[model samples]
Target chain A: MNSSSVAARGTVRVGPSGRYAWIALTAPLAIVLLLFLVVPILSLLRASFFEGDRSFNASGVSLEHYLRFLTDSYYLNVMLDTLGYGLATALLCLVLGFPTGYALARAKPHWRRWGLIIIILPLTLSLVIVVFGWLVVLGRQGLVNQVLVFTGLIDKPIRLLFNSPAVIIVLAQQFLPFMVLSVMSVVGHIDPTLEQASANLRANRWTTFRKVIVPLSLPGILSGLTLVFVLSVSAFITPRLIGGHRVQMLGSLIYEQIIVLLNWPFGAAMSAVLFTVTLTITLIVNKWLKSHPG
Target chain B: MQTRRTFLVSTVAAGAVLAAPAIVRAKPFDNVTLTLNGFGGDFDRIMKETVADPLKAETGLDVTYAPGGSSAAVAKTIATPDNPPFDIVLCDSPSVPELIKADMIDPVTPDKVPNVANLLPGLPEFGQHGVPFMISSSVITYNTEETQTPIASYADLARPDLEGRVALFNLENTGGVLYLLAMAEANGGGIDNIDPAFAALERIKPNIVTLTSSTVSLIQLFEQREATAGALWNGRVFAMQNAGQPMAMVAPSEGIYSLMSYYNPIKGTKHPEAVATYLNKALSDEAIGAIANFFRYGPTTTVDLPKAVADTIITFGPEGRAKIKTLDWTKIAEKRSGWIERFNRTMA
Candidate 1:
């Protein structure tokens, strides 16, 4: 090679060129992470430790807020209930979503597209609107009760809304799309020949699904569980709206402390706990998925 | 050279001073726009037509209204007290202590707003820092179509006949907190002691179809027949009644608490005089009457509203609205979070 051409090639291999490429790829995301996520989280953590009662302390910090959470059984119950509610919602979404996702994956192209659209249609609506829709459907004199009464199923309208079950149903409806879409993405990539091979091996449909298809979609299932569980745990509206006074989730408690009572320290402390628990759960699930390689 | 220059300057200064009165006569408002924090929807429309428009006309200052929740407004003010987002903010009386603590508001004086003298006798006087514009009340409302008997007192909620038919406010709401206090008072305890109220609430827990935090939820419960009787604001009950709902507003025999809406000039405002003037105009007879008619609230001022309009107002009774009760709001704010947590834990 000529000397000039060799010099140009040498320049291309320098660290600055590769460093520039890396920086270009990550700069925007790093800036966004610092400004929006990391900074806010640090501030919230700091605020969590501040002395607050009608106002936050500017001079000093304390652990009374966090200690309250540890000592107060009511708050402990709220945390446990929040986690339980999230788990139940996630499980419901998985069971109900898996079949729809599998059906979509196995359907014709047009059918698959239409089915996906219909499954995700509710996702486009705001949570408040969706809850309002549920209200109209599940209220005491709502559509379901009216229909049941018309069919002579019962003498009086059953109390259907304002309960934990209503909250779960609404939450399931809200998060089902996430579960279905994630599972569909994984299931769609599974080879049809593998299932056929299992069938040719004298495996029944249920066995084929259990042994072959389920393992292949484990990653999707894990991701959907993480998404639904995290969202459900952090949800404030569904529990407040559908659960009413019958149910009290951690999110609602946090909302009450901050917004209603203007108790920032306690609210921030509760939020920090929620964030830590959610992060620990997510990281553990992710680690499990990575270790299992499924 | 010095004498000639001084003469020239003096002539110009004198001429400008002589012409100042004519200039004042020409453009009174001088294109100043005042920002007001208020509630939206029908309240916004009524406030604009009755208070804002007339104030603008009288003072020559243009008015701009921004609406949001009182808590949000207080938060915003607290966030930027040095540079408040709005010139005037209409807030609830309960939030006054916090605002005062945060130093987010400026004090009013008699010279600034003459209408302050005309406010009702029992209303609060925050050293002129906040002025009560109107008084809204929390009352029990029943769906006439569904309810066979009138809800006469707070005790009626615990009766078996009202079982599974009542809806109460969630503790987050001021009305709900007042309800709790009223129940406590009726059940041999007072505001300082709310355990009795909790017991009362527990007794009526089966009757409470739901606990709501907003007028929309209360109205929905009534409309859907989920709740035949609910703890509701008198104004919303009136709105529902006007909307052709089979709803009736009842001032319970146990008494109801007043929720006073106050207007205050934001701290560090440039147009303090304009804000004070607007507040005064808001308290004027015509404006107060219009506001009372619109929201079905009692005017803080002694305005002679039409008899038909007066009949609908809770504070327009022959006893001159003296039956209303109120709690120590500062105490409420201090202990509210604990009470809410307890309520959440105890409620059905």
Candidate 2:
């Protein structure tokens, strides 16, 4: 073949030369990731085996911490609770966020702008402040209880904070914006004509939403789930603040070992477990989505 | 304009006169800035107002306060022994041994901190290694208005009437571990044998509203009437009462456990003299009184507190001294990790 034809074929193929260009483009980022992310995690993994408080002796390297976690039911329960809380948060966010996201996507300009602001306002505030605010709002004599008692709906205030329900509520509130924004972006991209076509075919509103809108927004929903799930699993502040000691998540457990007990080895080991669990769950979700694409 | 100028001139003159001693003493450390690390929350605020602010005004040493727990501070300092971030660190009694073991702190001599001579006897004396900052006793604090029956002992935390309405400290806190010791002692055990403590804690599991580290949460629990009683420091109980929460603290009949919070100068501080001067100021009569006024912790120094303030502070009064539970710091430093595990296990 002639040079021009060969070049055209090479461009279409994105051959080995293209691979080199791509690698070169991504090389700096790869190096950064290796240095900051991979190396630190590998160091944590290495440190996890060393016994004692920050003093790691090379001769004392063992799986004592991991063994403690594996044999102990208490640690296992914490692991289960962490994953369970993450799953509950992701599902709750989806349920609460999808409708709000859809409504925002379909709203008038002014209303949509304000609605978006309200949803994203929590993101602007720090997590500590958010949790503190929730504490005041959901405390035994908080706004809800005060209102209820004032209206003669209840004789006394109920215990609302520092429980599983309180944790779920706070987590849902903290991360709902992520879910909304993610789903909104995808919903905004869909052609309005599809919904109109579904309507013209006499599909009811609910039917249209389920059959057309939801399927179209599956990518966003899945992505939102992953983001929310990972964030919830790694959450330390909310449960720490409002959940009190009643609710224990993996993030707080790791914090307890590392900061409170000064057992860096055990803390690092717990961190490794968290990292592996989150990575495996994320990969599994991604693979499932890929295999069953909408 | 003439009157305003006169007022400004007089103010400047008076300020200079008052600051003359501090300025002279500060001449040597004119450019030095000491970093101080201590507990956060109310303690940080009180330390700033009572200790750091006055020291800065008197000595001209630019002090930066980094608030953190003692263990975390110890870990950070141990990680960088030769060039530590903090010039001086305020840690609880349990943390001193670990620091001493690591050789992170410089010894404090009476010559460096003359106020060390005024500290109460039998308080943890590191023999020039550390000086007592304040003394806090763990007590069973309750809302006087909420509960009909008075809580007289630590064991009263598990009273059936208090079920679902008690707030206790998490195991990692200094006051918290001390509370555990109190519980153990009340149940015929001590720190060395903490099994009884764990069992006692488990028995009170139903009454435990939460085991929290936040002083705000603990206060809110009582203020909102969610929790009627729990284990807390006498100073914290005093704070709650001062805030108009109708709170009262009961030093358990068995005995009360007190934590003698200590402060030490790190070995590699650039301004060791400045550190010494600041710590001396911290132990001064006026500063200690201010701390007692605000938080109700007993002054480590032998300053005669007014009766109103003295009544609330827990110290080595002939009777109070006899009741203070002695904790073995070295043993605690070794077994703390396991104790925390057991605490979590039982609570979880």
True contacts kept of each: 0.69, 0.62
Q: What DockQ number belongs to candidate 2?
A: 0.52
The segments of candidate 2 whose C-alpha lies over 4 angstroms from its true place after superposition are A1-36, A53-60, A108-110, A150-153, A288-294, B1-26
lDDT of 1 by residue, B24-59 (tens): 766456578888777888888888888778766666
Name the regions of candidate 1 deviating beyond 4 angstroms. Answer: A1-15, A54-57, A106-113, B1-37, B53-67, B80-85, B270-274
Supply candidate 2's per-residue lDDT for B325: 72
Residue A244, model 1, lDDT = 85
Q: Give the 10-residue window scoring lowest on summed lDDT in candidate 2 chain B.
A: B312-321
Docking band of candidate 2: medium
Candidate 2 C-alpha lDDT tens digits along A185-248: 8898888999999999999999999999999899889889988999999998888877888789
**Estimated TM-score per prediction?**
0.88, 0.88
